[model samples]
Target: MTYALTNMRRVLRELRQERPADVPARLWRYAKPKLDVLGEEVLYRARLMGPLAARYRGPGIALMFHEIQSNVDDELRTGCSAGHLRQVIHAVRAAGRDIVTPDEALRRLGDRQSAPFALLTFDDAYADNRLNALPVLQELDVPMTLFVPTGMITREIDAWWLVLRAALRSRSEIALPPMERTFQCPDLASKTAALRQITAWVGTDQARAESLSETLGPLVSDPASLVARYAMDAKDLTQFAQHPLVTIGAHTKTHRFLSQLSDGEVLAEFTSNKNYLEALLGQPVEVLAYPYGTPGACGEREARLAREAGFKAAFTTRPGHLFPDHLKTPHLLPRIDIGYTPQRRSALFSRLSGFQRAMTTRWGAPVAVLD
Candidate 1:
C-alpha cells in the first residue's frame, strides 16, 4: 500500500472528486492514521511470540527497505533511518535466525524450504544506501538485494517525489492544466486540495511525468536542466555485487507505474533494467521488483511481462508472509515493507504472528492471490 504512494497525485485526484472541499489535509490525516493503527497492531502481535523456534518456522520472508541515511532527521522521506536499519538487523540476528541470500532462499524454497528465512531488500537505489545502509549490512555480513531504477544511478534526489511534495506544500493558488481546473483556497487548504487533485494524475506513466513537470517545474530549484547525480555508480554496484553478500535486481528503467503502461512499454521497462543490471554485474539478473509494487502500479499484465522477460522471481510491496503456494508464480512474491516508521515493529510482529496475512486477506483481498 505504501509502495503505491509513488502515485500520490493519482490518489489525491480521486479524493478531490469524492470530497471537493477538503481533500488534502483530510486525506493525509485519514491515510497515515490507518497506516499507523495497522502498524501498532502488527507490532503488538510480533512481540507476543513466545520464543524463537528454529524448526517450526513457516516460510521465507523478505523485508523491503528504502533509503537509510546517517542523520535520522530526513528519515521520513526515505521510509527508514540508519537507526531503524540497525535495529531491524539486530532484531533478526538476536532471534538467531538466518539471513538468506536470494539464491539460497530460492534453492531452499525449491527443496520445499527449510526453516523460516529472511532476505533484506532495498528499493529505488539511493546514494544513502551506500553510505548508511550498506556499511551496516557489510559489518553484519548480511545478504541483501538492492533494486535500482537505473535512471537514478546517475541522478540526484528522486526528481518525481521532490516535485510532488513541493506542490503539496505550496500555498500559492496554481491552476493545474491536466485536470482542466484551478484550485482556489484561502491558504493551506488550497495547497492540500491541489495535492489531492494532482495525485490522481499518476494513473498513467505519461500523466505522472507530465503532472510532475507541470507542478514542480516552477518550484524545483533547477528544473530546466538535468543534473548529474550519483545514486550508486557502476563501480559501487560492482563492488557490492562482488561482496558475496549483496545482490542487485532491476527496478525498471524509469520508475514509471507499470500498470498504467501498454504491454510493449511494460516489456521495455522490465527487460531494459534486467539487461542493464545483468550487464553491470556480469551475471544473469533473474529477479525483478515492480515499480511502486502496488495493484495499480503493476497488475496481471505487468506480472506476465516479468515472466515473459525470463525473470525467475518478481516482488510486490504487499505486506505478508510467503507460503509454498506463493511459489506458484515466481513473478509474484509477497514482501514485507520495513519502512522507517515505528510501524515496522508492527509489520515484523504481524509477520511473526500471522496478523499480516489475516489483515491482507481481509483488507487487501485483491492482492491476496498474488501473495
Candidate 2:
C-alpha cells in the first residue's frame, strides 16, 4: 500500500507538470465513458420534460481535429486513429445532425435556424489530414476546413513544441541558457516535465527559446526528414488546397500564440499567411484559427486583428456548441477537440449532443458567451 501511494504521487506530479492544458480531462479519461453515459441519461430525462428542454440545445457545433493517423508512437498527442474518425462521423450523423461546412453553419446560424448541424476543422496542416483523414471525410461526403501555418510549408520554421519534445525524448540532459536551467531527462516522466518547462519558456520568449534550441543543435539526427515526416510541404499544401470539399484557412505565419505577440506581430502573422495561402490556392482565404487556440493563447486583441486583416471568422479551442449569439462574435468562435483515445466515440457524441455544454453551464455560465 505504501509503495502504491508513492507511485500515485509520482504519477500525479508528472501529469500536473507535463499535461497542464488538459489535466482534469486526462485524469478522467478512463472514467469518461461512465460520465458520458450519465450525461446521456440526464439529457434523455430532460427531453422527456418537453419543449422547454429543447431550448437549451445548440443550433450548431464545430469539431476540431489535429492529426488523423493510426501511428500510436507519434510525439504529438492530438491525433485520433483513422478508425475512430470514421466512427465519429457515423455517430454524429446517427444522432440526426447534419454535417455542414463552417461557412454554411455560419450562414444558417445568421438565418436563425434551430436545426442541429456540425462543422469539421483540421489544424496545423498535418500530412495525415490528406493521407488519412481526407479519404474518410470524402467517403462520408463531409466538408471540412483546413487551417495552415504558411511558415511550415515554406520551411521557414518548424513547430518548436515538437522540436522541444523530440529533443527531450532523445537526450538525457538539456541546457536552457535563457532560463539558466538544465533538465535531466533520463525517463519519459522526467522528459515530459522538462518539455513542459521548456514549452512554457518558449511560449513566453520564443526568440530566446529558438536561439537556445539552435545552440543545442539538432535534436534528431535528420532535421529535414523530421519536418517532412510531420508537416505538409508547399507541394502537399498545393494539392490539398485543390480538394473540392476542403476550405483552406490561415493559421498564422509561424504558428505562434497570438496573445504572446505584439499587435504589429499579430497583424503580420495574419496578413502574411492569408496572402500566401490565397496566392497559392487561387481562392479567397477569409477564416483564421489561432495557433494554440486557447483563451490564454488568443484573446480579443488577436480576434480584432484577424477581422481587420479581412478574415470573416476566427476559431478558438474553447469547448462548446455554437449558438445564434456566436454569430454576433464570429471571430471568437468555440470548438470541441476530439479525443485521441480508442473509446472516445462516446465522449465525441456527448460533446456533439450538447450534454457536456449544458452540464458545464449548470455549474457556471454558458460556454459560448454572447458578444
Candidate 3:
C-alpha cells in the first residue's frame, strides 16, 4: 500500500512538475499507434514520438510481435519478415537492453528489480515462427514468449485481420454486406481504409467475427489454406514447446475480443484455453495475452478474470514501458508493439527505447494501469 501510494504521487508529480504537453489525456491510445503505419498527425505532432522526450522509462517493455513472415499487406501491423526479426534482436541488444522471456519479466518487475529489459513476445503462434523466425531468433540466441490461440491450431478460426488484408489485395472492389457499401482497393491507402472500415463493422463484437470470416473467406483465392499457411498446428506446438528459448502461453481459444463477451464467456475462454494449452504442451501454461488487447477490448474485469483463471500474469496491447505500479496489476501488463514495416530504424529505436511513448503520452501518465 505504501509503495503504491508513493508511485501514484510520483506519477502526479511528474505530470504537474514536468508539465510535458498533454495531447488531451487518453488520446495516446488512439494516436501513438497510428503514426508508424497511418502516419497521421492529430491531437499532437506525430513526428514528436521520437529521438528523446525523457519520461515513462518503466521497469522494462514487453515488446509484442506477431508473424515473422514476409507479406505485402501485414494489416495485423506487427507481422515482419525474418530479416526484420534479426534486425530487432540486434538493435535491442545494441541499445544496451536485455531481452528476456515473459516469466523473467514478471519476476523482475514483481520484485521491483527494475532495469532496462525487453521481453520479446510473439502472438497468435504463427507457423512462420518455426519456418522463418526460429532461424533468426536461434541465430540471435534470444528468448521469447509465443502466445497461441488454440482455435487457430484446431482449424476453428481464421486470424480475420490477415484474411481481410488478403481479400483487399485480391480484388480491386469489395462489396460490404448489411451496409451494402463497396470499397475500392486500387491502392494501398484505399485497401487499408477498407480494412479498418470492415473491421469496425465486425471486429468489436465476437458475434460478428464469425460473420466476418464467413463473408470474407470467399474473396480469398484459397480461403481454406489461410489458417494452414499462417497458424501453428498442434504438431508445431508440440515440437516448439521443447525449445530452450521458447515459452508457450495462451491467447484464448478463438481470439475473440473479450470486452464484447459476457463475464461467464470470458472466464470460460480463459480457463478452457489454459487447460488445452497445458495438455498439449506437456508443461504449465502460466501467462496470457488478450485478443485485441486495448481499453475498448478489455479492462479490470478481464484482468481479474485472468487471475481467476489461474494465470500467473497476463498482457494487454497497451503501448507503454512497464513500471513498478504494474506489479500491483500483473494481469494488465503493457507492451510496445514493434512496427509491421518500420520506416526508419532509428525512429523505431526511439520508440523501443521508451522515448517516443513517454513524449506523446498525456501528462506523462501511463494508460490508467491499476485503478
Candidate 4:
C-alpha cells in the first residue's frame, strides 16, 4: 500500500511537470511477437473460455488500431505499427473466436445474448492499409473498419504526432531539414514542460489548436510537399475503399477532440467528417471513433453529439466488453488497445481482468489516479 501510494505520488509529480521530452513515443512498437513460440501457460489461460466468460459478464471485447504497414522502420518510428498483425491474426484464429464486423459488433452490443466476439478498427486512414494490412485481413477473411479523417484526402499533411516529431527534430541537428518552430521550450526540461502544458491545452481545447494549425500550416515551409510525403490523398482513400473487408468510419474532420469544443463545434467536426466521407465514397458513413478515444478526450456530451449526428455507433479507448445497457449511448463503444510489443501482453491481460472485476462489483475503485 505504501509502494502504491509512492508510485501514485511519482505519477502525480510527472503529470504536474511539463510533457515528457520524448513526446512519450506516440505508439510503442513490439520488439518481438508477444506470443510464446513454445506456447506458455498464459496462452493456455487466455484460451480458457470459462475464466474470461465468468470474468467478463458482457458479450465480448473489440480491439482498436491505427496503422498497420510492412515497413517496420516507419512503424517503429510512428508507434502505430502492427508489425505482428500476422502473429495477432494467427493467435486470434487459434483461439477460435469470431471476428465481428463493425455493424455486427454494434448490433451485438445492443443484444445481451450476442456471442463472444471482437472487431478490428483502424484510424487515420494511411495508405499502408491498402498496401499492407488489407491483403492479410482479406486472406484471413476478417472484417475491419478504417476510420479516416476525410480532410486529409486532398492535402498530404502529417498527423499531429508526426508534426510533434518533426518539431522535435527541428530543434536537433539531426541532419533533417528545418521545420517552422511551433513552440520553443529551449531545453529538454522546458520541452517536456511545454508538452505537458500543451497536452492540457489539447485536452481542454484541441479544436482551436487544430484550427490554428490549419491556418498556420501553410506558413510552414514546404507545407504541400510535407503533406504529400506523410498522408493519404483522396486518390489513396478511393483505392482503399474498394476493398470488401474495409468499411469506412468517421474520425472527425481533423481529428479534433469533440468534448473540448462547443456543441456546434462538435456537430461541425462530426457532420463534416461524415459528409466528407459520404461524398468521397458514395455511401453513408455511420460509425464513429472519437479522436484519442480516451476518457478525458471526450465524454457524455460528445457521446450524445455522436448519436445526434446520426452515427449508429461510436467507440472509445475504454477497455471492456459491450452489452445492451452498455449501448445506452450506442455511439460510445469501448475498445481494447492491442500493442505490438510482447511486453504489452501481460499488461493488457491484467488490465482486462481488472476491468472485468471492476464491472462485476461495480465498485468505484480507482485503477489509477494522477493526484
Per-model TM-score on C-alpha atoms = 0.76, 0.78, 0.81, 0.69
**Highest-scoring model, TM-score:** 3
Per-residue accuracy of model 3 over 1-371 as CA lDDT, tens digit each: 55335434433543464335663453463345555444422212544543344465566778888877666344434367877778888878876678888877877777664556888888988888888888877888899899998888898875677677788878888886854676656655556556766777774676566666677888898887888877888998899989999999989987888888889999999999999999988899999999978788889999999999999889888778887788788899887778466435645665565665654564367543732
**Residue 75 of candidate 1: its Cα lDDT?**
26
Cα displacement (angstroms), candidate 1, residue 263, comes to: 1.9
State the weakest 10-residue window (summed lDDT) of model 2.
48-57
lDDT of 2 at 225: 55
Q: At residue 319, what lDDT does model 2 achieve? A: 72
C-alpha displacement of 300 in model 2, angstroms? 1.2
Reference-based lDDT, each prediction: 0.67, 0.75, 0.75, 0.61
In model 3, which residue pairs have backbone atoms overlapping below 3 Å? none
- Model 1 agreement with the true structure over 267-364: per-residue lDDT tens digits: 99888888888887798887888977876687677778899998888898766655666667667787777755544565565554445656556544
lDDT per residue for candidate 4 within 1-371, as digits (tens), equals 55335434444554445456533432121112223322333543575423543445356566776556555333333434444666666655554457878778767766766666667777777677677787788888888888888656656333554454344434522111222224543344334333444445556455545543454454456544555565678878877787778898898886765566789999898998899889988988989988888767777888889899999888887766555566566666677666343324444444333343343335333221110
Lowest-lDDT window of 10 residues in candidate 4? 25-34
| Residue runs of model 1 more than 4 Å from their true location after superposition | 1-57, 94-96, 154-158, 165-206, 224-230, 342-344, 363-367
